[model samples]
Target: MKTVTNISDLRQQVKDWRQQGLKIAFVPTMGNLHAGHISLVEEAHKHADKIVASIFVNPMQFGENEDIDSYPRTMDNDKRQLIEAGTDLLFTPTPEIIYPKGLAKQSYVEVPNVSDGYCGESRPGHFRGVATVVCKLFNLVQPDVACFGLKDYQQVQVIQTMVDDLSMPIDIVPVPTVREASGLALSSRNGYLSAEEKAIAPALQQNLQWLAQEIQYSRKTSPDHSPDFIGLAKKAAAAIDATGMKTDYIHVSHAHTLQPASEDDKELVILAAAQCGKARLIDNLQLSLA
Candidate 1:
């Protein structure tokens, strides 16, 4: 795959592709290549004629105490994986290339409401960094379609809201979360887990699955009664903590708006974040009551 680091060179290549009438698909990621990330590129291959994947460990998206400096950067491996996954072009822009005026002076994008709770609440200014950098990448890549993993459900929602509100012509595709056979959702942070912690990691997904099943069973058996979502979330969080992980937040919300799930809401999602050793892991499950 052709790798370009500058904006002008990247745009020129995209322009050439546009002139050829080739549809483009984009996948933006931090530089830790894994099976989960490759899955995104594979999904992109189905939607467009050429795939454009970017690896910019966005400093804007990371918080003050977050792992920006220590975030994994496996460039040689990442390039090999992308080429194997059929990525046509790789855009590896430096932070300066992305934010010429510096982050303090850079223009930012914020999608209100959806970016308020869950991870947003846990990490202030996180979504602001996410929206702003994603907005910049969307502008630079200008692909017809972009694929994002549903493992980061709120992030997908925030980006979707941003694109719709801004009238950007890019289609946002939500790909399913790829997991290990043990049920652990793959994340770069997973590398931080000790062997003991790795064994406990699958409990996060298990708790979410259990919560989904409980909600489903409650709806089926007690059609007239509203399920106690807040209580269920608390129970799940407690169960996760019982497994030696510290719960950050476990919430049930409307799938679309991300507001607290009400009795009348048919489409719902359960999101959870927990600290397992040095790694902070997040996972979610969506339910369609309709």
Candidate 2:
């Protein structure tokens, strides 16, 4: 795969591909690739003739005390993996290239409502940084389609909402979360987990699955009654905390809006985030009441 670091060169390559009438798919990431990221590239292959993957660690997304400096960068392995995954173009832009005017001067994008709670609440200005950078990349790559992982459930919602509100023509495809055999959803942050924390990590997914089952059971057994989502969430959070991990939030929300779920909402998602050693792990399970 050819790697282009500058915006002009990247745009020229995409322009050349467009002249040939080739469709392109994009997968944007913050380096430290695992199997989960590769899965996104694999999904991109199904959507377009050429795949453009970008690795830019945006400082705008990280909060104060959220050490952007320590975030892992494994470009050698990342390049090898992208090549194997059939990525046709890799855009590795420096911070200056991405934010020429600096973040304070950079124009930003924010999708409201869906970007309001969960990770949005936990990490202030996170989605603004996300939406802004993604908008910038979308303009630079101008892919026919973009792929994102559902492990970042709220993020997908935010981007989708942004695309719709802005009326961008690109299709936003969400790939499923890739996980270890123990059921822990794969994340770049997972690398920070100590061996013991790794053992305790899958509890996040376990509790989510259990909560989903309970929600389904309640719907089936008591068709006329609300399932008490708040209570179910509390139980799941307590269970996760019992595993010695600090629960950030365990919420049952309407899958689409990421708002608190109501009994009438057929499509639901259970989203959670927790502190596991040095890593902050997030996971979700989607279910249908209908």
Candidate 3:
């Protein structure tokens, strides 16, 4: 509906909304919205009286050689989807407004231990960028609650840990990963897949599915050595490699701390990353292999 690009204008509007006794819900996105993003808006609408969603293509969250320039930015399409999904206000700010002093000059937020594994290992500073921008958004909107999709499971873990550690009063609600009928996790990056890469894309999901199945079979057939966690990790890697993936990292970790699982009955997160041509993809499935 209404788009407010300036921070002061958005703040004045939200102050008015709060005076009316409306509870606010905020959803921060990097534009290029899809069904997965819409899914977050739906959850926010259900929980808060006033919904404020911001479309910011953050510069801080990107790494050297990463797709900051190539990353999708479909603002017109994104606005229509949010309005149709019942988002009340669109706070689309320029990078200058978000990081007035510039990214290099802005303060950052961090969460320990939880950021030690998974994507954190390869991307380096990626999560810090994420935490910083998210913290900025939180301070900007000051919503009673915020919604994030579980598709970015590690990100959710990081933000949840940050809120708890700092005693920030905002409630963080997480929605499950939304997928296409073919099983690929819906992402803005999916737009980068080539014709051949698109055909090969579902294998990311297939690899995670195979990891789940392998754990099941390993438990049934060889109950004596039923839960060989390391073997499951290797099998997941082999599946990704066999699928023509240029690997990033495949990890099996505890669902909470994200530390690699070493014993039985521990919840496991099977996360894998790889590139299909120039497009990078990630997918994960949580299972009880122990």
Candidate 4:
């Protein structure tokens, strides 16, 4: 695999590869390569002749209080994994190379409406930071297809909206979430979990499970699937509390819109976020009352 560390080098390399009639696929990630990221790379390899995976832990997307400096940087090990995964080009660029002017003064992109809720509601300007950097990467790599993990499900939606709105040609492909057998979502933060936290991390998944189970339990007794959305939200909140998590917010909402749905809307998602020890995690489960 070619390890590219500069803008011009990647541009020239991509140009040469395109000249050889190779189709390009890109997977943009922050460096903490795990099975989740490798799964995306594996998906890219299935279709594209060349896969260019970037490892830029974008500073723009991180908040002032967020774990930017503390974010895991396992580059030496990451490179070894990408090589094993059949990645063709590894674009490892600096912040200045990406943002040029840096984040505060840089031009940013935002996807409207859909970016208003879920993680977006809590992390103000997060999607703008995400959308901006992703837009920049799309221009830099100019891949025919860009692969992302479904682990960041809402993020994939926001990015797709941005691509369509701006007429970016890259197709956004969503790969499923890679999980530990414990049912905890595989994330870089998982590394920071204490043994006690790790033992209970599956509670994040179980909270989602509880939300689905409660909604169905209520439905079966009512003979009507339309349980109160606010009540269901409370039930979700209670389930999260039962997990010993400090609550963020919980909702049964339209999976696509992420707007809180009326009770009558049987198709929804149980989205929850909470703090577990030093780490904050989120998980979601789809619930369709039939």
- What's each prediction's TM-score? 0.99, 0.99, 0.94, 0.94
Query: lDDT tens string, model 2, 23-134?
Result: 9999999999999999999999999999999999999999997999999999999999999999999999999999999998999999999999899999999999999999
The per-candidate count of clashes, in order, stands at 0, 0, 1, 0
Show the colliding residue pairs in model 4.
Answer: none
- Which candidate leads in lDDT? 2
Show the lowest summed lDDT stretch of 10 residues, model 4. Answer: 223-232
Q: After superposition, how far is residue 64 of candidate 2 from its true place, in Å?
A: 0.7
Q: How would you encode candidate 3's per-residue C-alpha lDDT over 180-278 as one tens digit per residue?
A: 888989988888888888887888888788777877787788776646667767777777777687778887778877887755555878777888787
Question: What's the C-alpha lDDT at position 86 in model 4?
Answer: 96
Worst window of 10 by summed lDDT in candidate 2: 254-263
lDDT for predicted candidate 4 compared with the true structure: 0.85
lDDT (C-alpha, whole model) for all candidates: 0.94, 0.95, 0.85, 0.85
Off by over 4 Å in 4: 217-225, 263-266
What ranges in model 3 sit over 4 Å off? 220-226
